[model samples]
Target chain A: MSLTHREFWMMVHLGLGVMFLHTFFEGILWLHTGERLRRLRIGTGVMALVAWLTVVSGTWLVYPWYRAKPPAGADLADYPRAYLLANPSISQWHIFGMEWKEHVGWLSPILATAVAWTVLRYGGQLARDRRLRQVLLVLFVAAFTTAGIAGALGAFINKVAPNTFLDG
Target chain B: MAHIEIDPVTPSIIEEINSLTSSSDRPALPNGQAGAAILSAGIGSALLGFFVVLAEASTTAKQLMTLDAGVGPLSGKTTFAVAGWLIAWAVLHSRWRKQTIDFARITMIALILLGLGLLGTFPPFYMLFAQH
Candidate 1:
C-alpha cells in the first residue's frame, strides 16, 4: 500500500496516541496501587509531552490537509472534509464526528499537562495525600476519556475518508 | 527512566509517612499548586467548548477566531483557551502557593467545569447553536 506524507503523519499521531494512553493508564495504576511514585511522575511528564504533540500535530498539520478546499469543479477525493460533506449519507462524519473530534480532543493535553505537573510536584508524597491522588486520578481519567473519544471518531472518519495525499 | 525504589504504601504506612513528613527535610508542599493547575485546566477546557459554540453560532465570531486560514477558527479557539488556562494557573498559583487550599471544593468545581466543557464540545450540543 502506498503511503502519503499525510498518511504517514497520521500514523505517527496514532502511534503516539496509543503510546500516551498506555502510559497514562500505567500512571493511573501506579497511583491506584500507591507505589512507584517517581516512576509515575516521569512517565506522566513524558505522556503529557506526547499528548501535546499529538494534539498540536493533529490540529496544525493533519487537520489543515483534511480540511483543505478542493479547487472549483475539481474532484473532492483529496479533500476529506469536502468529500465527506459532498454526500449527505456521510456528511454526519464531518459535521458530528470531525467536529467533536477536533474540539474535545484538545482537552486531553491540557488536562494531562495538569496531571503531569501535579505528579511531578508531589511525587511519592501523593501516596500520603489520598485526596490529592483521588483528584488527580479523576482528572487523569477524564483526559483519557476525551482522548479515547477523539481517537475512536478519528479512526472511523479515516476509515470512511482516509486523509491522504494522491501522490505517494 | 531510572527507578527510585519506594516502599508500597498501605493505610498504616500512609499514617506513618504523614507523621514523619514534618520531621523529614522535605515537608509535603501545599495542595495549592495542584489545585491551580487542575482548576485552570477546567477553565481552559470549558472555554474551548464555549469557543466552539460561539464560533458555530456567529459568523463574525468564526471569522474573528480564524487565526490561521489553514486551520480555520480552531487555531484561535485553542490559542485563546490555552492562554486563558496559563493565565488562570499563574494567578491562582501566586495566591495559593504558600497556603493549603481546600482541594475538595476545588475538585468539585473543576469537575463541573470539565463536564460543561465536555458537554459543550459534544457535536449535538454545540450544533444546536449553529447558525447555518
Candidate 2:
C-alpha cells in the first residue's frame, strides 16, 4: 500500500533520528581515544545534516498536519493533536509530550550545525587540543540528548495517536 | 641498534601534541574561533527557549509568530532562533578568529546558558509563564 504524505515524511523523520544517534555514538568514542579526529569531524557533519532533515521535516511538513485544527463538531480521528487533547486521559500526551518535543527538538540542529562548522573550520587543530576536545564532547553530547529526548517523545506520541494518514 | 636523528630545536610528535593540548603558554592554536562556535550554539539554544517562553506568555507575540498558518507559531519561533544564532556566530567568529582566548571560561558560560535553554523549553517551566 502506498503511504500517505504524512506517513512517508514521518517515516523519513524517524530514519533521520536513527542516523543522528549513530553519528552521536561516534562523537562519544572521542572521549575514550582521540585517535580518529577526522572520523569525528565527519560524524559531526553528518549529525548536523541528519538533525536538520529530522527537524525541518517534522516542523514544516509533518507538524502542519499534526496540529491541523479540527472544525467544530468534526471527528478528531485524523488530527493527532486534537485527538490526544480531546480525551481527558490522553491529553497529557499532547499537552506535555508534544509540547516539549516540538519546542526542544529544534535545538538539536542548531547545536549540531555549530559543532559541524567548528570541526570543519579547525580541522586538524582539534586533534592537538584537549580543551577543544572536551568542550566539543560536552556540547556534542548535549546535542545528542536533545535529539534523543525529542525522538523518544515522538515515538510515544505517535503510538498514542498514530498519524496513519494526512487529514487535510 | 639503529640511531635515530634527533632535532634539537623541534619537539617530538608526541611531545608537541601533548604540549599543544596542555601547556599554558601555548597560545598560537587559534582556539578562539572554536570557542566562538561553541558559545554561539548555546546562544542559539537560549534564544529558541526565549522565543518559546515569549510565545507562551503573550497572546500578541503568539499571533505575530504565526508566520505560517499551517505550521503555527513554531514557524516564526524557529526562524528567529536560527537567524539569531547565525548573527551571533558571525559576530563572535569575526572578532575571535585571529586570537586565542581562554577556552575554559567560554565552555562554562556556554554550558550554563545551554542548561537554561533546556529548562526554558520544558512545558512545566514555560507553561508557568503562560498568560491565562
Candidate 3:
C-alpha cells in the first residue's frame, strides 16, 4: 500500500527515535559492565545511519513538502497557529529554536560516527579510560537530547506551520 | 604501529581486549580516524551547499530537483559526503600505520579539523563577516 508523505515522515521520525533509545541503552550497558561491547560500536554505526536518514528527510524532503503545500482555510482552523504567531516572543523563540535544531540536527550524525570511530579505534581501552568514557557518554547524551528536542520542535511546527501534511 | 601491551589494568575489565586485538575482520583503526569521518562529512556537505547556493539555476532546474537530487545542497550530497569521509579514513588510516600516534593527540587533531569544518559551514567565515 502506498503511504502519504505525512505517514512516511512519521515513520521516519519513529525510527529515528527508536534508534536514539537503542544507542542510549547500549551506552548504559557499556558503562555498567565496565567493558567494551564490540556490538555497541555497531549499534552506534547504525544509529549514525538512521540519523543521516532523519537529516535528509527533514532537511530536504519535509521542508520542501511543507513549503510547497502549506495548509489553508478550514484545514488550519483547528490548528494552533495563533498561539505561536499572535505572540512575538513565542514566534521568535520558535524560530530561534528551529534554526538551532536545523544546525544541531546536522551535527548529530557526525557525533554518532565519532562515537563509533572512537569505540573501534580504542577498543577495550576506551572503556578502561575514565576520561574517554566520560566523553563518549557526553556525546551520546548530546545526540539523544538533540534528537528528542528536534522531534518536539517538529511536532510544534506541524501544528502551526502552513503545511499540506494536515490538509485532507 | 607501536602497539601498547596494556596489562588488564583492572579485574573488572573484560578479557575482550586481547581478543579484539587478535581479530582480523574488525581491524583497529587509528585514534583519529573517526574524527576524520565527521570532519569530511560536515565539510563536504557544507561545501556542496555553498556551491549550489552560488550557482544560477533556471526554474526548470529547481523544479527538477527531486529525491534523486533533493534534501542537500546538490544531487548526491550524501554520496559526496561519504566519499570525503572514506578518503579521510584511508589517509588517516595509513598515516597511523607508519608511526606511533597517541589517543589524546588524535582527539585534539580531530577536534581542530572539526572546528575548521564547522567554521567553514558559516558563509561569514569566507567573507570575514563583512556585509556583502
Candidate 4:
C-alpha cells in the first residue's frame, strides 16, 4: 500500500533518527575502546557514511511529498505570502514547483556527500585520537540531540496542525 | 701501619640527600590532563547547546513557513530541553573529571534518565500527554 504524506514524513523521521542514533553509539563506543585511534576512526567513518545515506534518502523522499501538500490550516498563510511578497523570485519559481527543488532538493545530495567524505577521510584519526575523539563525541552528541528535538517538533506539528489540502 | 680505617662516606651522602628530599616538596595531584579533558568537554557541551538551539530554530522556521510542515513550537521546545540536558551531561561525564564515586553513580543514573526522556518524546506517551 502506498504511504500517506504523514506516514512518509514519519518514515523519513524514523530513518534519520536511526541514522543519528547509530552515529551517536559509534562515537561512544570509540570513546570507550582502548584500541588504536585507527580502529575508532574506521568505526566512526563507517557509521557517518551510513548516516549520510539515510539523511540524503530521507530528504529526497520528504521533499516531493512535502511540496505536494499545501500548508496545514494552522500554518500562518501570512508567512508564505509574506515570503513570496518579499522575494518575487521565490514566488516565480514556486509557480513551476522549481522552488522546492531549488531550495531543498539541489542541496541534499551535496550535503550528504560532503558529510560522508569528511567523516571517512578525517574522522577515523579523530575517533582514535583522544583529543579528536573528545571533539567528535561532542559533535555526535550535539547532532544526535538536535535531530531528536527536530523530530519531536515535527511530530507535534503533524499532530496539532490542521491538515489542509497542502497536508495531503 | 699508618693505614687508618676510613669509613665509607657513600652512606652518609645518601642519607643526607634523602633527608633533603621532603614529601611535602613532591608535586601536587596531576591535574593537567584532567583539566584539558574538562576544558574540551565544556567546549563540546557549549557547541552542542548552540546546535540544539539552531536546530530548534530552524524547525520552528520551517514549520511556520513551509506548507504542511506541521511540527509545533511546543514540541520543539520540549525536545530541545530534553536533548540539551542529555548532551550537557554526556559532555560532562566524557570530560572524565575527578568526581566522587557517588557523583559517578548519579551520572550513570542521569544518562538513563536522559534516554528515557528522549524515548518519552516518541509515540504513545507523546500522543497521550501532549495532545491539547
User: In terms of DockQ, which candidate is stronger, 2 or 4?
Assistant: 2
The residue ranges of model 1 lying beyond 4 angstroms of the native Cα positions read: A1-3, A162-168, B1-24
**Which regions of candidate 3 are displaced past 4 Å?**
A1-3, A28-36, A69-94, A125-135, A162-168, B1-86, B112-132
In order, the TM-score of chain B in each prediction is 0.80, 0.78, 0.40, 0.30
What is the descending DockQ order? 1, 2, 3, 4
Per-residue lDDT value at A127 in model 2? 63
Residue A146 lDDT (model 1): 92
lDDT of 2 by residue, B1-110 (tens): 99999787455566545533553344445777888898999999999999999999999999999999999999999999999989999999999999888888998888
Give the winner by lDDT: 1
lDDT on C-alpha atoms for all candidate structures: 0.86, 0.83, 0.54, 0.40
- Candidate 3 residue pairs that clash: A60-B71, A70-A162, A71-A163
Candidate 3 chain B: worst-modelled 10 consecutive residues by lDDT: B50-59
Measured over the true interface residues after superposition, the C-alpha RMSD of each candidate is: 3.6, 4.6, 5.1, 16.2
Put down candidate 4 lDDT per residue, A44-115, tens digits, no spaces: 555555554544444445434434323456444323323333455555433323222222221222222222
Q: Pick the candidate with the highest DockQ.
A: 1
- What is the DockQ of the complex in model 2? 0.39
**lDDT winner, 2 or 4:** 2
- Candidate 2, residues A90-165: lDDT per residue as tens digits? 9999999999999898888888887788777665566666777777777777888999999999889878895654
Candidate 1 lDDT by residue in tens digits, A11-112: 888888888877776888977876765567678899899999999989998888888888999778788899999999999999899999999989999999
DockQ scores of the candidates? 0.44, 0.39, 0.15, 0.02
Which whole-number lDDT from 0 to 100 does residue B53 have in model 3?
32
Q: Is the docking of candidate 1 incorrect, acceptable, medium or high quality?
A: acceptable
